[model samples]
Target chain A: GAGVSQSPSNKVTEKGKDVELRCDPISGHTALYWYRQSLGQGLEFLIYFQGNSAPDKSGLPSDRFSAERTGGSVSTLTIQRTQQEDSAVYLCASSSRGGVGADTQYFGPGTRLTVL
Target chain B: AQSVTQLDSQVPVFEEAPVELRCNYSSSVSVYLFWYVQYPNQGLQLLLKYLSGSTLVKGINGFEAEFNKSQTSFHLRKPSVHISDTAEYFCAVSAPGNTGFQKLVFGTGTRLLVSP
Candidate 1:
């Protein structure tokens, strides 16, 4: 039904400024993911989208992190200057299919991001 | 390039007295396994997956997981656990089929404290 959906459950940036986190998946789920859960990279895997773009950003960890998914669905993860270790808790997921070899993902209700 | 290793970040049981949450993965090929559960604040919810033909996979509340192909591992058990099963727990790996857009590889979460 209506499962995946992510927004500003919580965001408090400041370290360097620049923050944007959002996700909305589940309408048809075409594979979408972005993970981050502090406590020393306990939930890494930073970018993924199959309909809009993104082949596999390599779990992005450098370049301040980045993400995008427009027409196919909705996904955004921009952390530019922010750092304080980038805070934590930023998750989003969606799946119905994911071609390389795997499927079964459904998550949302995250966006802690607190880089004070 | 697939990897998943959730070797317990936290596990303190008591409620029922039988719990095991340990997942391991390192793809050489063929992949698709999952077990998601997040309670406090909410997000992930899969709880069970093995894809193939029974390797001992059962999920939802009662919990159960076992897909050990040569010991690649996909362990998540629950003989007697409650207290809402505490919280956090994730172990993912993907790359199967369809086009929904698969790309999952999570492991670095395990926080289940079911005390009495």
Candidate 2:
């Protein structure tokens, strides 16, 4: 079976521009998550989506960061007015189900975003 | 809220030597624990997890972790390591979210430098 996958393996953008990162979770995965990995911040959770439930936006760093999962499979993380500080590896993951501690979340090759 | 700490930023070992990466977490409620490995230029991969039952959990690539409730620690250990084991290891914790689903928190990460 195909594992989780992300598009645009690498993206470089001007500081003030906007960028979108996409994620395709494994088949039948009902839960998806977004995280950011940077040298200064390590790994930080950004957002989460569960089937039909309102997305958890608490982890989002700011209003500039937002995400949406359409048709319960593909997810897109959009960053508006990007800053140099936004440079990092954006990772996506999915699980068979949400709210269960025992469920395993599989990850995808992250999209590295560089803001200059 | 939950937080994870990987005190050792780096661990170096000779091939076939035993190694341990320490991890500690803080949370008010019961949480699930996990260890993940990330090879250079690759996505994060699950090494092991501890949700319930036995504290000793085994994972892929001859790695294992012991979940110690009293110490609030889940340390990864391997009896012997190979040069191929060089990578970054992450420790994570998850607890119920506001919506009653699990949300994960991750540690800074420990870089394992295995040399022949």
Candidate 3:
């Protein structure tokens, strides 16, 4: 079966530039999540989307970060006026259902975004 | 809020030797524990999960973990390791909310170095 996929495996942008990362969840998956992994650090939760419900934006660090899932399948994470602190690997994951203990999340290879 | 701790930043073991990665977590409510593995240049893959029932859970690639409620630990172990097992391992926890939406909190990660 096809796994979750992400675009732009590596992205380099200047500070103050805007960058967008894309994720394609597995078929039939109704839950998607976005996370960031900094160097020598664990993954940091960013946002979540489950079916038709309102997305979880509580984890967003600031107003510059936003995400949207179109048609409940693909998701795009946008960071406006990127900062050097935003340089990290952006990871995307999906599960068969939404909930805490519902299912295991399948992750994408991730997009490594570098802000110079 | 829940938080996970991977005590060891790195663990080096010889091929065919036993290995263990220590993980501990703290949460005020019931939680789901999971172990994930990330190979070089790859996304994370589910190694195992402990939701309920057996305290000892086995996962793919000959890995297992013991969930200890008293100590708040879910340590990953393998009898004999291979060079292929050299990768980063992460411990995560999630507390389900009333709406059935859960967010994962991850540990810093343990880097396993398997030498042949």
Candidate 4:
């Protein structure tokens, strides 16, 4: 079976520009998540979408960060007015029937974004 | 809220040598623990998890973690690590809320360097 995958393995942009990172979760995964990995902040959760419930955006650092899962499968994370602090590897993960204590999350290759 | 702490930022070991990566967490309520590994230029993958039933959880790539509730620790250990095992290890915790939403809180990660 195919695992989770992301597009644009690498992206470099200037400050104040906009960048979009995409993620495709495994088939039949009802729960999807976005995370950011950086030298300063480590790994931080960005957003979460489970089934049809409202997406959890609590982990989003700022208002400039937003994400949407279309048709409950693919998710896109958009960072507007990118800053140098936004330079990091954006990771995506998915799990089957999330919220369970033992559910395992499969991760994608990740999209490395560099904001100059 | 749950948080994970990995005190060791880096660990270097020789091939076929035993190694231990310490991890401690703080949480008011019961929590789920997990260990993940990330190779260079790749996404993170699950190493092991401790949800219930047993305190000792085994994972892939010859890795295992022991969850201790009294000490609030879940440390990863391997009897003899190989060169291929060199990677970054992360300890994470999650406490499901009333809505059963699980958001992982990860540590800063420990970079393990294996020398042959």
lDDT of 1 by residue, A40-116 (tens): 76777677777897777777888888888988898888889998988889888878765544467778988898888
Worst 10 residues of 3 chain B by lDDT: B94-103
Q: Residue-wise lDDT of candidate 2 within B41-74, one digit each (tens)?
A: 8899999999899999999999999999999999
lDDT digits (tens) for residues B1-116 of candidate 4:
78899999999999999999999999998888999999999999999888888899999988988988999999999999999999999999986644668788899999999998
**Per-residue lDDT tens digits of candidate 3, residues A1-116?**
49999999999999999999999999999999999999855698888889645457777899999898989899999999999999999999999887656479999999999999
Q: B30 in model 2: Cα distance from truth in Å?
A: 1.3
| Best model number under lDDT | 2
TM-scores for every candidate against the unseen true structure: 0.34, 0.97, 0.96, 0.96
Candidate 3 Cα misplacement greater than 4 A, ranges: B97-100
TM-score (C-alpha, index-matched) for candidate 4:
0.96
User: Which has the higher lDDT value, candidate number 1 or candidate number 4?
Assistant: 4
- List of clashing residue pairs for candidate 2: A99-B101, A99-B102
lDDT (0-100) at residue B6 of candidate 4? 99
2 or 3, greater by DockQ:
2
lDDT of 2: 0.92
Comparing to the true complex, what docking class would candidate 3 get? medium
Tell me the lDDT of model 2 at B68.
93
Task: Return model 4's CA RMSD, one decimal.
Answer: 1.4
Worst 10 residues of 2 chain B by lDDT: B95-104
Worst 10 residues of 1 chain A by lDDT: A96-105
Could you tally the backbone clashes for each prediction?
9, 2, 0, 0
